[model samples]
Target: MSLDPINLAAFLGMALVTYLTRIAGLALVGRLDLSPRAQAAFDAIPPAVLIAVIAPSALATGWPERVAALVCGLAAMRLPLLGVVAVGVATVVALRMVA
Candidate 1:
């Protein structure tokens, strides 16, 4: 199959813009001096975003997901990010099996 020239150019343009934006962010962040609290908040963004994305889907279904999300929310307090994720996955699996 032949590649369409316009599609290829559009893809390349998008890739270049994305790469430049990422590079600009890295440079900007490196130059900034943020407070400890701000740093912590920045670090927390990923997990917060992950939960925001996952929560709607989790809550949309039946009782299993609701219960699993509750367990995961508790686990997030004491556990690290990966551990919290593991707990959530395990809770969902076990609950799905039993229900």
Candidate 2:
């Protein structure tokens, strides 16, 4: 529960790697020609990766938090993304307060 040099270093390292990979891909993407089917699949990868990264953390936090996030995510899908996140955060805070 403390911010330390080691944690910061690790975070920076991961961020650097992520940034480089994304930048490299963006730079190289136009140089290659992907088939229509492959392009469609590639387009979906970002969301899939996001879900894979978020799902575990959301689930590990417990049912209440997960439910809040789902409702928020749905709302975000329908409304603004920021609004959905706010609603989900509010839900979690309210639940925690009541409990």
Candidate 3:
């Protein structure tokens, strides 16, 4: 299949923007001396971002998604991170098949 020039340009532009933002973030953080509270907040970023991305879809979807998210949360309490993810995915797939 042939690549469309416009789509290729758009993809490259997006990649460049993503790369620049990551580099800029690293540079900015490297230059900063954060207070303890600020450092703690920065550390919370990953989980906060994960929830921000997951919460909307989990809440908006039907029972399968909600139940899967709950399973993930419960698994997280007792299982490794990979296991938690596996449980979540399995629950969703099983529920989807049943429905």
- Best candidate, TM-score: 1
Model 1: lDDT of residue 36: 100
Q: lDDT, candidate 3, residue 83?
A: 82
Rate residue 1 of model 2 by lDDT: 75
lDDT per residue for candidate 1 within 15-55, as digits (tens), equals 99999998998999999999999999999998989999999
In terms of lDDT, model 2 sits at: 0.80
**Best by the lDDT measure:** 1
Give a tens-digit lDDT track for model 2, residues 1-99. 789999999999999999999999999998989999999899778657766877788889877778876876688567654566678778888877776
lDDT of 2 at 57: 83
Error of 3 at 11 (Å): 1.3
Q: What's the TM for model 1? A: 0.78
Query: For model 1, what is the error of residue 69's alpha carbon versus the real structure, in angstroms, after optimal superposition?
Result: 0.5
Taking all chains together, each candidate's TM-score versus the true structure is 0.78, 0.54, 0.68
Instruction: Give the winner by lDDT: 2 or 3.
Output: 3
Q: How close is candidate 3 to the true structure, as a TM-score?
A: 0.68
Q: How many backbone clashes does candidate 3 have?
A: 0
**Which pairs in model 1 have colliding backbones?**
none
Q: Any idea what lDDT model 1 has?
A: 0.95
